[model samples]
Target: MCFRIVIFVLFSISASMAQEPQEYLDFILPLIKEAGKELLTADNYQVEHKKEVYDLVTIYDRRIEDILINKIKKKYPNHKFIGEEESEINGISNLTDTPTWIIDPIDGTSNFVRQIPFAAISVGLVINKEQTMGVVYNPFLNECFTAIKGEGAYLNGNKIKTNGQTDINKTCFTYELSLARNEKYGDMYMYRLKHLTRVIPGIRSYGSATISLCYVAAGRIDAYQCDGLYPWDAAAGVLIVREAGGYVCDSNGGEFNLMDPNYLATSTKKLSDEIMAIERIADEERIRDAKAKTEG
Candidate 1:
C-alpha cells in the first residue's frame, strides 16, 4: 500500500510538471548550478578513456549525471530519462512517446579534464518524440544556454539570436577534427577537412559540441558541422540553435534527425545551402577517388 501511494504521488507530480512545462527550467537550473559548483572546485578530474583516446570521461561526469537523474526521477517519477553515464552502463535506451530527458552530464570531458571553459552539462526534454526544452550549462565559464520549444532561446537570462551571415567563405566554421580519429569514418572526415580548408579560410574545433552549438545560436560562430554524436550531445544544443533562429539540417542536406544527428547548423538557410553544396562536391570526389583506388 505504501509503495502504491508513492507511485501515485510521483505520477501526480509528473503530470503537474508536464502541464506547466515551463517550470522545467526552474527545477533544472538550480540543480545544474549546484553540480557546477562541485565541478568548478574539484581538485582531481579522475579522467578515463572510453572507446577512443580522445573520448574521455571523468568522475564528475558520472557524479553530476547521477545527481541530476536522481533528483529528477524523484521529483517526476513518471518521467523517463536517457542520460550519458546511465546509457553507457545499461546500453542506450530507446525514446518513447513518454516525456523523456536526454542528458549529457558533461558534454566536453576532454575540455573539463584540461580546464578548458568549453565543457558543459547538457539536458534536453523530449515529449511525443519532439525536442521541447534544452539547457547547456558550462559551469567553468558560467554560461547557461536554455530554450523551450517555440519560446526562443536565451543565454544567461538574456535573449540570443544568430548573426544571419550566409556567405560560405565569410562564415566562421567549426568542425570536430578529433573525431576523425575514428578508423571507419576517418577517411571521410579527412576528405571533408581537406576540401573545406581549401574553400574556407580556417576552422575551429573547440572540443565541445554543446557549447559550439550554443555558440551558433549566440552568433559567436556562424556555422558548425559534426557527425557521430550520441542523442544526448545534440538534443539540447540543437534545439537551442533552432530556437535562436539558426538553420539546422542533417549533414546530408536533409531534415535533422535527433537520433542520428550528423548536422550542419548555420546562421541562415543560404549558408546552409552553400556549405552543403560544397560538401556534396567533396564527397563526390571522395567516392571517385575510392573507386579509382579499388580498380587499381
Candidate 2:
C-alpha cells in the first residue's frame, strides 16, 4: 500500500510540473536575454545566397540561435526545436507535433544589420504543436514581452492588457511593408495603407513584427497588419495580443495559425474586419491593374 501511494504522489508532482507555464517561462526568458546580449557584439556579419531576394541571415543571427538551441536542448533534451537558422542550414521545411521551441533568433535581420533598434529575439514554446509560452526581447530597447498560455501577458514584469478602444478613426495604425514595392502583394498593401491613413489619425511603421505586436499589447498602438510574416515572427506576439483582449487572424477573416504567412492583429474584431475590407478593395484594384496592363 505504501509503495503504491509513493508512486501516485510522484506521478502527481510530475504532472503538475509539466502543466505549469511559469516553469516553462523560467526556463526560456533568461536564455533569450543572454542571446540578445551576445548578438549585439557581432559586427562582422556575412550575408550569403538564399532562396528569397531580401531574406538575409547574419553571423549574429546564427550565434544567437545556436545559444538558444543549445540551452533548450540541454535543459529539455526530448523537446523539439525549430530554429530559423537550423531550418535554413538543414533545409528543413516542416513544423512538427512534438513539444517544440519556435525561435527567430533575430526577427528583423535587415533592421539588425542596419543597427536599427527595432529588431528582436523572438522565442516561443509549443506543446503538442500549440504555442503555449513566448518571450520576445529587444536588447537595444531593453524591453521584454512575455506570455504564458493562460496566465496573461507581461511587459517587464507588469501585467499588460490590450486597450479596449472601439473608435476606428481615433485609433493609431502600424503597418509592415515587407513585400517588394513593385510586386502584386506590395501594390495591394500600398492601396490599403492609403485608405487607412485617410481614416486613422496616425500611421507608423517600426519594421519589427515582434515589437509591433508587443506595442499592441502595451496599448502603444491600436492595430497592426502585414503580409508574409512567418510563424516564428508572430508566434509569441499572437498570444500576447490575444490575451490582451485583442483579435488576430489572417486577412481572409479565418483563424490565424502558426503556418499562415499573413497576420492582421487588432484591438477589436470590428477593426480587423474593416482592415480586411480595405485589403479586399486593394486586391480588386491590383487585379484591375493587371488586366489593364495586359490589354494595353
Q: What is the lDDT of candidate 1?
A: 0.88
TM-score of 2: 0.88
What candidate 2 gets wrong by more than 4 Å, as runs, is: 1-19, 45-49, 179-184, 292-296
Model 1 CA lDDT for position 65: 90
**lDDT value, residue 106 of candidate 2:** 88
Model 2, 1-296: lDDT tens digits are 99999999999998896677688898888888878777677767567546777788787878888888888899889888778888876753466766788889988888877888889999888786777888889999899989888778899999998886677888898988765433647667766777777778988888888899989988989898777667788778888888778889886678887876578889888887777777687777877988999999
| Top candidate (TM-score) | 1
Tens-place lDDT digits, model 1, residues 1-296: 99999999999998786656588888998998898897889799777887667678888888899999999999999999999888877887788998899999988888877787888899999988999999999987789999998889999999999999977787789987674445556777778878778878758999889999999999999999988888998989999999999999998989998988889999899999988888888899999999999999
Segments in model 1 whose C-alpha atoms lie over 4 Å from true places:
1-19, 179-181
TM-score of each: 0.91, 0.88
Cα RMSD (angstroms) for every candidate in the order listed = 6.0, 3.1
Clashing residue pair totals per candidate (backbone < 3 A): 0, 0
